[model samples]
Target: MYRYDQYDHLIVRERIAQYRDQVARRLNDELTEEEFLPLRLQNGLYMQRHAYMLRIAVPYGLLSSAQMRMFAHIARKYDRGYGHFTTRQNIQFNWIELEQTPDILADLASVEMHAIQTSGNCIRNITTDEFAGVAADEIMDPRPFAEILRQWSTFHPEFIALPRKFKVAINGAVEDRAAIAIHDIGLTLTHNEAGEAGFKFMAGGGMGRTPIIGSVIRDFLPWQHLLTYTEAVMRVYNSYGRRDNKYKARIKILLKALGVEEFARLVEEEWQDLKDGPETLTREEYDRVAAYFAAPAYAALDNIDPLAAHADSKPFANWLQRNVKPHKVPGYAAVVLSLKKTGVPPGDATAEQIDFVADLADKFSFGELRVTHEQNLVLADVKQADLFEVWTLAKSKGLATPNIGLLTDIISCPGGDFCSLANAKSIPIAAAIAERFDNLDFQHDIGDIELNISGCINACGHHHVGSIGVLGVDKDGSEWYQVSIGGAQGNDSAIGKIIGPSFSGGQMPEVIDRLLQVYVRNRVEGERFVETAQRLGIAPFKEHVYATPISKGELVGEDHA
Candidate 1:
């Protein structure tokens, strides 16, 4: 895990002091709501339906035990005694008081964390794969580059007010766990013919009103020019991006207006002046950042043979099948601690659960953990010998929910329940689906289905990429969920297509049941839900979902597709 130096420490402390005064002025009526909107948003504060919400950045999803403990303390002392982790690899406190936010930020600053750049029309937190360093298929560790970007983007004067909020994601692994194709700018670390490290740049990928898969701008960029080239792209976007309409402000919309060839040419032309300037990365600087993420002291497995022998237990086997993933290190594994229990909202953790995980990280994972974009936590370097013990402790705490890629492992946003922008509630829909698919055996039989729900088309839940995507809509002041099929995330990412009519909140569970049943009846053995849907198209599922009502008064016949 990366620690803050004096420079990092100074920046956050000064920002906290500044925001503290700003909050005081607002409370005293020295600032009106309109006057204080941008000021508060700059500090990651948002006015939600019930109260203010604060989002705290978790840089590249990495956390140390100390930082985890800080989050626990924040949840216990600030807002409610829980925090919701988000798909962007950040955490949100829903019941915040405007007056208390400065103190919360100050506490966060104490632990080398801050909420700066988590909101606002600025470059947000740079994210990467959760299994960056220890993944078996990684080309390189991306956190060093992500950290470099974080340092470069935080409070960068040039991007303070962009056309809209921007995001950047990097993927170093063969698997695209970061969902790079849907970010404002996406980078994939790769090697050139000379075997030297560089990047493949993708630009204008986003998922709001218009979901787009980013286009390849540069097939290969030398490592030294990484920052300079990025600056060039930012300059191009900041120059021509639409500012009049918020809907058309994202770089993706801009890219659509200007073709990829012209956009790439513009970026290349801008890169001429900045390519080898002060921003060109040096080997020493890269090494400095990379050294921080080097492997920790892992023990030899031969020393713990006794514990490793006990992995055959039924519970341990089930957990091992779902929770544990292969590690690059010989005797270690990456353990996923699921946050998607049946009753709990996806990606939420209570204060006690936070503390418990913090302790577990210290005990089993070299005091470090990583948050996944899929709303789960990863003990990235847990020794194989400790797997059984970790499983036992986790199961007791309601954290061991052997359903990582199953239907019940849903991804959802805090919809009408917390966000003012939401058109309908998302939590109840997620809970209902989870309850309906509570059978783990059944879920495993179905296999690798992603179900994502968003309160609105803003797509905060990444609903655009789910195998079964659910979007809440405001239809005549009532909540309606429109379903989409065949959406996917990762290297082969694709936005789902609308299947048929929108369903009332009451019909969502039954609709999902019919879709799954259709899938089971038509799918070949060993095929995942997305593969089956793609193979058979959405017709079979659509037919089953929109079939004549089993009962007289059913609303399934409605046609609002």
Candidate 2:
């Protein structure tokens, strides 16, 4: 939780004034829709199918309880009664009024938050693991570096109008919870043989028209040169990335055209003049940023099995197993507040739910919480002794579904319902799958699955890396769903392969059921669905899904794969 300085406050206030004038001009007919497009996009405002959508940045997914309460207020006053959390750990309001946007921005600014860089063809929000500072497996805390990048990249003149939107993610843990492999620029905090901290830098990774896992550009970049090296990569991209077609403009496309070796060479050549320059991070600067993320005070206590007393309570035991994660500190845990309730849209929270979560964070988690890229919220420092109390309160609010990493814990985008770019509605399909596997016993039996749904190929829902991916496509003016298998996130991330012909939306539940059956039949003991699919390849699952013949009317489109 980085506090805003006087300069930070001044910057936000000035931006709010500028945007207010811009909105007024648009409303007064002084600026036409064409003229207002980029201006509004710079502030994270979008003209959707039905109304405007506003995306607010939650940097590195960190939020204070006070800020969460502000979000609740905005949800209640500005746009409908709820807001949708996104895969990037940002939040969106679907129904926004054109004239009220400035007021909303002002409200956000009051809380040291803004919509800046949430959209536009510039560097977007920098993201990382939700459990960054507290993960037991972390080699180092990455938030300081993430914050440094945030400060450096915001409104950088060189990158204000890049070829396409750029995303960066960093992971400090052994597990790749941040999905570093699928970002434009990915960094993993590591140590050299001498045990000095540095980063394993990768570039040219992205998902969209073309999905690519980033290639490691530098095995060990010294920590001090983080900014200089990053600027070098951006300089290479900004210089040669395509400008002719928006579809081919991402750095990944450019990297593919020119081989990785050439890209690395170019970056190194650019780094020669910039390395060890004034932009090199000093130890004092690192300490100043790191101070903001220092651990909260804790009483002397020993680790205890909080679940021992709840052995007879199946609900409590199940929740403990699924929603609670181990903490780096003794007698503490990180608790996930599930947003994947069966009837609700994935990652959405109502105003009351938002307020309730804020209260819970204050009471249980040092007045702070982190938003997971999986569309859940984490109370990163809850006492293990208070697990049952936290669970009880969250369950009453429909925020404790006990489905983390399970089939029911789906990651989905606001599809045709809110986004004009979507091909089909994503919410209903996600609901169908969640309802089908509503039984906790069944989901647990399936074991640690990442099911992602996207309305289109943009991969906002990250379907490309799901254990099972559902993508919405338009076929002959009708909405159809495509299923893919063997996709996974983390260190060994891979894009999923389409199983066969696309099926109608109505057939999705059964299609998923069939895929799971193949996994169950072929899997050896202790293997997860993705591992089993990898071991057997896509042939068995494809055969199982298409085994039962159907009428020609049921098929929507032939598999492009």
Candidate 3:
């Protein structure tokens, strides 16, 4: 919700003009594809398998209804009828015309949005919990710090071209909804024994071919040194991170090669010179940014039990149980508009649906919504009294599936369908799984689960951290799906282990069903799928999934057959 000032306005307008010129040159054959590649990437344009894909940044996942409407307009006018929301909380249009991207960006700039730093080996969008300011468990709102980082890092000359892409996530809540452990740099807002707010800094966490959790670099970095310390970390990585191979270029690879102690030592040595310098955040600067995120005006009212009145309404009760979240404020609730309807691609919204969500945000929330890292949208400040009405409207638009955190609430990437880098189609795999578990009663019985699907090892869908992960692989020039179990995100984040050999796309649903059976059988009372998997380990699940040889007919569709 940070409004652009004169300087912000000037910077965006100038960038757009520069990109417009660059795009024109590319079209005119004045600039070769090699020359225009970096320029276009810097602007978040990609040449996909079919058409160009444009990724627009939604900083810290915050969006005003006005911005949402702009997205809807862009989807309707420039791209196809729908856009894909990504795991990073950004949105992508798959059928973009390279020539029209500048116009699209100009349209975005009108709403104080841009596509800068969305791709390339630079610091991508800084992300955090969708319920940042409204979470009951938050120690402090993390958005101000996130915004401060955003302002500082945008086009920073030193980090514009790192050895590989960098990502940072900050979490202010007791729960790690932001998945801090799997970021290049992760910060947890905390207070020192002296009651001074600071961060628990962790670095080197990432997922790809080599998945590893970040190590804590500093137990308590005082709030003032946030920027200085962050710069120091970047400086260390930039100085020594590998440039030879893209696979080993991430900071996590560097941290692994050097060890945590040495990495921390280097960062500290670098920080000594920068600490307490002008880059150190002062109270006044903090306040300036914090003002934008001050609490919204609320009506004086007591909290009410929403379920009391909807007890007889099964549909309403189901939606309330899955989609509604507790708010920090009384008389309010945060609602997730589920994008994981059975047949729809995960995290995709049609132009009309996007507009409808914008309308809902205006009517129910404070004209705002937050995009969850889980590929859902959150109306973070809905009145509890208006829950039913919100649900009714959302369900009518196929945005109220009541499957948040459940098996069908899958997080998936636009795989072979849109991304040239993908090995197999991810959307269909997600669709098959969702259809398999469409029964609400069966899903609730399975309990909270994070099921993620990625087309490749890039981990864009964050399959490495899902309770059940499905990864698409290229096997003998054929697309096969690999299943992993026991992974989880949050305070106790862990990378999943591959159960066994890859399966045909058609075998994915049956494979998942077998994994769940193992979970249900081994789980004790009150155990979730992840808890049960962790307790019994992957052996039992692996055995059951591959135990029975599937008939040849099962491999007939969407596979090498």
Candidate 4:
């Protein structure tokens, strides 16, 4: 993890002081809501339906055990006894008091953390693959570049008030776990023909109301010019992106209107002037940042036989199968703590759970933990020998759901329960679906299905890329849900297609059941839900979900890719 320098600490402390005064003014009525809105948003504070929500940035999803303890303290003392981990690798504290947010931020600053750039029209948190340095297939660690971008973008005057919030994601692994295709600016780190490290740049991708995958603007860019080229791209967007309508303000909309070729041409023209400026990355800077993310020390040990160790326990075997992932180290595995337990909203961790996990991280993972973009926590370096003990502890704390990529490992936002922008509640929908597919055997048979729910088209839950997407809609002042299918994340990411008309919230579980039934019936041997859906178009599933009163023969006839 990157530690803050004296300068870093000084800047955060100053920002906290400034925000403290600003918040005091708002509470004292010296500043109206309109005047305080931007001020508060820049500090990552939002006025939700019931109370304020404070978003805290967990840079590149890395958290030290100390930082995790601070989060636990905040949840226990300031907000309610819980915090919500979000899909962007950040955490949210609902039920915040405006007067207390500065104090919360001060505490975060004490731990080398803050809420900077988590909200507002400025460039939001720069995210990367959660498995960045540890993944076996990684070409290079992407966190150094991610941290470089974070330092460059923080309060940059040119980009402070862009047309809309901008997001950047980098993927360094052979598999694109960062969902690079869906970010405003996506970078895939790779080596060129000459064996020099560089990037493949994709721009204008986003998923709000208009979901579009980004197009490649540069097939290859040298590592040295990374920041300069990024600056050029942002300059073009900041200058020409739409300002008329909030709905059409994202860079994706700009790319659509300008065409990818023209957008690339403009970025190229802008880069010609700024390619070798002072902003060009230097060897020393790269080395300095890369050193911070170096791998931790590990004891030399042979790989343990998990099967032999847990021979008598099916529960341990099940957890090992679902929750544990392969680690690059010989005697270690990465364990995902599923926050999507049935009946609980996805990603909600109580203060007690947080503290327990912090202790677990200290005892098992070198006092470090990671937050995944899928709304889960990861103890990324747990020893294989201690797997049973870790599992037992997690189970005691209600963290051992053993459904990392399964249907019940849902990704969802705090919908109508917290956000005023939500049209309906998403937590209940997630719970309903989790309950519908509660059987572990049944869920495993379903096989690696991502069910994402969003309360509205803002797509915070990333519904556009789920294998089964449930989106809440407002229809005639009542809650309705529109289902989409065949979507996927990773290198082969694709936006899902809407099945048909929206269904009532009460019908969601049944609709999901019918869709899964369609999948199970039509699937060939060893086929996953997504593969089956892709093989047989959305017609069969649509027919089953909507109950169109069509014959099986008619559905078969319509199932053409």
Task: Report backbone clashes per prediction.
Answer: 1, 0, 0, 0
| Residue 281 lDDT (model 2) | 98
Candidate 2 regions exceeding 4 Å error are: 550-561
Local accuracy of candidate 3 as per-residue lDDT tens digits, 309-413:
878999899899899988999999999999999888889899999999999999989899999999999999999999988988999999999889999999999
Best by TM-score: 3
Using lDDT as the measure, the top candidate is 3
lDDT of 1 at 190: 96
State every prediction's TM-score relative to the real structure: 0.97, 0.98, 0.98, 0.97
The reply for model 3, stretches above 4 Å from the true place, is 552-561
Please list the C-alpha lDDT of all candidates, in the order they appear: 0.89, 0.91, 0.92, 0.89
Candidate 1, which ten residues in sequence have the lowest lDDT sum? 552-561
The C-alpha stretches of model 4 lying farther than 4 A from their native spots are 548-561
lDDT by residue for model 2 (1-561), tens: 799888778888998999999999988999999999999999999999889999999999999999998889999999888989998999999889999999999999888999999999898999999999999888899999999999999999999999999999999999999999999999999999999999999998988778888899899999999999999999999999999999999999988888999999999999999998999999999999999999999767789999798888998999999999888899999999999998888999999999999999999999999899999999999999999999999999999998999999999999888889999888888877788789999998999999999999898999988999989999999999888888888999988888888888778888888899998888899999999988898899988888886433332322211
1-561, model 1: which lDDT tens digit per residue?
788988899989889988889889999999999999999999999999889999999999999989999988988988679999999999998988888898899888888899999999999999999999999999989999999999888888898899999999999999999999999999999999999999999999999789999999999999899899999999999999999999999999988899999999999999999989999999999999888898899876642332357646766666777888888878788999999988898999999999999999999999999899999999998888778888889999899999998899999998888899999989888887788789988887888999999999899999999999999999999999999999998989998989987888878888888989988898888888898888888888888888766321222221211
Candidate 1 wrong stretches, greater than 4 Å = 302-312, 550-561
Cα RMSD of all models vs. native, in order, equals: 3.3, 3.1, 1.7, 5.0
Superpose all Cα atoms of candidate 3 onto the true structure and report the RMSD in Å to 1 decimal: 1.7
Return the lDDT, model 3, position 496. Answer: 92
10 residues in a row with least lDDT, candidate 4: 552-561
User: Cα lDDT for residue 418, model 1?
Assistant: 84
